[model samples]
Target: MPAYVGAVQVINVSSSGVFHIGDVIQIRPISNTKTFSGAGSFNTGDGLAIYNQYSATNTLDNDGIDQGINFNL
Candidate 1:
């Protein structure tokens, strides 16, 4: 079977800007935003929320917890 895709949007960002590998990018729909309609469905009004953090240690940012987990495990 073939894979299908819904709404596709391309955004051009600044190359000179300092963007970390784990950065969250959020996009809000304006008054004229449109959604995709057909075999697949797209929700434009909801907008898009991206979470870039992958490591639990990085997210927690606590050395005590990390030590506890390491000792317990």
Candidate 2:
């Protein structure tokens, strides 16, 4: 599934069963690195003066789902 830039997706682990409407699921952002550059500041030689980087790790949340997910750059 494709999640939005700032949205979150939860995946539940189970052998076999029809999940109920409110059944709790186990999931977390194994890795989230969202970056952005400011348009307000720009240098003639360098480019944007301001930059932001966001990263998510297991420590950010404790959903217990290990093993990193693959992403295509």
Candidate 3:
């Protein structure tokens, strides 16, 4: 695949952004952005839940729900 360009105007590019102008073979760009408001927890369990503020994981290590229940009856 290829593209033909004459004139281009780029106002701004984010920190995780890329801009290129040329005849290229392959271009692979990856950007992983995460935003945390209250908290960021992974596989958390609370017995008696209180004022709750939780966040989920963006990785592959998390269980079913980022927050869980491990009860021993």
Candidate 4:
């Protein structure tokens, strides 16, 4: 069987510039584990958010966090 992959939410935090193909971006799941959604802004250490720092070129396939979500940018 194949591994189950959940839907991910992409967010933009870069300066005023168009996103490129290989541009790295932050992403997280839209679940109850975090007090966030695909809409609106958020702050660090909001809720039970699972923090992850991934590149758009690598996505969740690279190094990331699973304990809590917090962005310092």
The reply for model 2, stretches above 4 Å from the true place, is 1-46, 51-59, 66-73
After superposition, which runs of candidate 3 have C-alpha atoms over 4 Å from their true positions? Answer: 1-4, 30-50, 53-73
Q: Please give the TM-score that candidate 2 achieves against the real structure.
A: 0.16
Residue range 17-63, candidate 1, lDDT tens digits: 34333334653322322243442233255656644454222233345
Better of 2 and 3 by lDDT: 3
lDDT agreement with native, every candidate: 0.39, 0.45, 0.58, 0.42
Candidate 4 lDDT, tens digit per residue, 1-73?
A: 3455576555974443344333355633332242423322334565655545642332343445555434423
The 10-residue segment with the lowest total lDDT in model 3: 64-73
Error of 1 at 23 (Å): 27
Clashes of each: 0, 0, 0, 3
lDDT of candidate model 3 versus the reference: 0.58
Give each prediction's root-mean-square deviation over alpha carbons. Answer: 21.6, 16.7, 14.3, 20.1
Indicate whether candidate 1 or candidate 2 has the larger TM-score: 2
List of clashing residue pairs for candidate 3: none
Q: Which pairs, if any, clash in model 1?
A: none
Q: What is the TM-score of candidate 4? A: 0.13
Q: Work out the TM-score per prediction.
A: 0.15, 0.16, 0.32, 0.13
TM-score of candidate 1 to 2 decimals? 0.15
Pitting candidate 1 against candidate 2, the one with the higher lDDT is 2
